[model samples]
Target: MDLTGKVAIVTGSGQGLGLAYARELARRGAAVVVNDINADTANAAVAAITAEGGKAHAVTGAVGSTEVAQALVDGAVETFGRLDILVTNAGMLRDKVVWKMTDEDFDQVLNVHMRGTFTCVRAAAIRMREQGEGGRIICIGSPAGQRGNFGQTNYSGAKAGILGMVRTWAMELQRANITVNAVVPVAATAMTETVPFLKPYVEAMHNGEQLPSFARRELGFGGPEDAAGIVAFLAGDAAAEVTGQAVGVGGDRLALWSHPDMTTTAYHDGGWDAEAIEQEWPTTFADHLESVGEKLPEEASAQ
Candidate 1:
């Protein structure tokens, strides 16, 4: 979809998936404000976009800062006259099992992915409301958040929190015509390369070796561009009605995620006492309990 004359801001866009989103938006005719903590990479992204006949400017700063967030929004309007889209894609990983994870690691991930998104969205929403043209706010989420990963408690918590914000903002901004959504992307970026299980294939790709067919079939479309298409679609006019969604994007696949809901419940006249609940526990909740990283009896043999 064409985004002609629309001005957009993408954070953490110095490289990887953020860069892909920025470049694609520019290619679709939107003037872009590329924000990154690294000045050199931000400048390079801007130069690349400009060289390809697209409009873009670099804003270098840590996205978690309120001042930086405000500057990004103001800079976009100052450079391009209006803000229409925001892609909060700035993030980092500090993977460690829960027992080993430091408070610093946890806070750092949350600061960038969670607080960074909040600050940027808060700033962009103000501008969009003032301009009287409702805008798109796209937050990048992760599969790790939806289904927990072994060593990513911090990252997963932050990403899952983003989806919560997306739903809340979508409802709050509906009257203003703004839509907020989350994209849970599985892409082979610097972040994904950190996973020990995926490291061999990532290195193989870098070395120009042909990937095993099964592996290729599963993850070949894990490139940033593959996921960028969905971001571009959500940012465009066609997706105005598609807010509050957590959409999965990966290798040749796009899927809608179910929102949290009460699946089942057990009730009694004037809630049961602890003794009564214990007596009925097996019949009320035991059989219906959700699995936590465990295989069902039917699938145990397959493993």
Candidate 2:
């Protein structure tokens, strides 16, 4: 439960879930590099951690570029002596359906979420490998990525790509003793507040009203702090053996998500032609068809 002497970096730590992760890591005795694009919030985060008797430094800048990523790693190493944990939690959304999504919307989300994660994790990996002391790389994923969501063409695609990279990095970095995993968190944040169906629940949380059991238990929605523990846990030695996992957390709920796999398969000699596929689809594949889009109960939505 303690992370004494560990040096860590948390991206997008100015506010919301990223800030929660930074605070939790610091509380556990890790020296943290708080990174954000905003100067005020970044400085505030560093100050808050210092007031709590934790060590922190602010490195303000947008992520996603090689230079920024390298600068963050350099900042952590220069300030704390060594780096042990890296949380690639910086992200943004440009929600729009496929037809309505402009190039700007799609490119921007991918640049910040997927590419940002890539550059940051790549820089951390290089450093951690050189240190040969082992390290933790925690990436952020979303339920929308697991299952498609309406008006989130850009977001869902980027998140899904991040998970894909996590699995690959888990294998690639295993020899270096670096563990990689994803935390699929659901919380009341600025991002979730923008969702049309979740506005009331977000407002309720801000107003200090109790959320319904469904929101807590089923939707796994709660304050950002509720989801912060998993990040802290994954960053510590206790979770050293855990890697290549998508662990979900929120209020009243914690669960493991299965990786994507082929559910059903059939073999046909020389591969089936169009007519042959049509003939066998009903018996061989039709029964295994899968549906997309986020599925929530009517009760959860109506709330």
Candidate 3:
């Protein structure tokens, strides 16, 4: 859609990927509500948009709270009269392996990422349903969720939960014309710098900044704008037929999203035969792996 008169509320729009998405949307004629916990950053983003001849306003509040979520929706309606798009982009990280993870670490990540997404979506959907003109809900996901990360159990779990929620929301809201899709982006941002394991990978992504010598060996990293384009499309009429799907945007590549392989094949018939299972189960795995012309990797096969 052109979005000339639409209103968009983008959570965590104070900076980084969220700011890029909100600014780009406003540039396309949407009146944006730049929502962020940092009042100064949110206001700065709005000011920048207005300086560029676009309509935008800042709404500062915690994204994890229902009250703040409602306030953001209300701000959009109060300022622009109606809501057309909601970008649930607020998130934080508390990286730790599952074994080393603490209750506080896990709960904090879930609260900010998963619960925060629901807060904004729930509040926005109410407004969209009331308006009866349809709306867009675009969420931010991560590859860490798709391929489990080494030290980010909490982050991956929250991101994966979003995809599950997206599928359910699509089934319930499609008839109302509200499309809910997610963008799994691997862009360089401030969050990346704080993670010990991800710092070098992210620092290499700085557009005008210097890259470390080691980073020169890798292809490169993506900028925030690289992922914003897809979000804009999802929020517009161009993606009217797309819903309940996650798009992976990383650097110069985009992928048709896939979920984890959670299924295991076993020989079975209409009834479970103890004798058959005992006789065939041991050989099934070896035979299957051999058929692929390669043995399972030594580490995994040994296990």
TM-score of each: 0.91, 0.98, 0.85
Clashes of each: 0, 0, 2
- For model 3, the superposed segments whose C-alpha errors exceed 4 Å read 194-201, 207-220, 259-264, 270-279, 282-303
- Top of the candidates by lDDT: 2
Ranking of models by lDDT: 2, 1, 3
lDDT of 1 by residue, 46-116 (tens): 99999999999999999898999999998998889999999999999899999999999999999999999
**TM match of model 1 to true structure:** 0.91
Q: Clash pairs of candidate 2?
A: none
lDDT of 2 by residue, 69-187 (tens): 99999999999899999999999988877999999999999999999999999999999999999999999999999998989989999999999999999999998999999999999
The alpha-carbon root-mean-square deviation between model 3 and the true structure, to one decimal in Å, is 5.2
Query: How well is each residue in 147-208 modelled by candidate 3, as lDDT tens digits?
Result: 66667889888988999999899989999999999998866787666744446557555547
Ranking by TM-score: 2, 1, 3
